[model samples]
Target: MADLKDQRHPQYMGDRQIVTDLLGTTQPSDRNLADLARLCIRYRGFQGARDIQADLLKVLAQWHLTEEQLYAKTREIHTTAKVFATHNDGRDDWA
Candidate 1:
């Protein structure tokens, strides 16, 4: 049988680095790294949504807006963008 350690996928290796960087750990245990890699690959769109969500919450708090309010504002912005696009010949120049 092939050795488990030898079976580490390239994507998992890349994810291991991302996991370590996000956790601020240089050398996490093999098991912990494997678990993180698996979780990132299998769920949350293959990215660390947990940490990103926390950061987004902090930004929202700093802006003094609730989650629902943020969504409402985002929708408003998109609607405005569509109007602008119509005026600009269907070109979305706003990034």
Candidate 2:
């Protein structure tokens, strides 16, 4: 993938750096990046584009995200976490 540093947007550039540190040559795509970006915004309640990009970079760098048949799996995970937090009152007692 092209160097994320080459991206114009400040958020995109930061994310690219973080993702590169985290995922190396496997920088995330528009779709996955978008979802991950959105989740960061939602969870952090105004996590500017830079923050979203940073979070996405952390996630990608830490995971072995598959390249084929990509989907919003990260978003789903974020959604599930939100639902779990809402329903379980931020506790693990519900199991």
Q: How well is each residue in 71-90 modelled by candidate 1, as lDDT tens digits?
A: 55555555555322146466
lDDT score, residue 54, model 2? 55
CA RMSD per model (angstroms): 14.5, 11.8
Model 2 lDDT tens row, 42-81: 3343334555455554674455543221235645555555
Q: Candidate 2: worst 10 consecutive residues by lDDT?
A: 62-71
Name the lDDT of candidate 2.
Answer: 0.45
**Residue pairs clashing, model 2:** 22-61, 23-61
The model with the greatest lDDT is: 2
Deviating ranges (above 4 Å) for candidate 1: 1-48, 82-95
Candidate 2 regions exceeding 4 Å error are: 1-7, 24-69, 82-95
Cα error, candidate 1, residue 91 (Å): 19
Residue 30 local lDDT, model 2: 51
> TM-score of model 2 relative to the true fold?
0.28
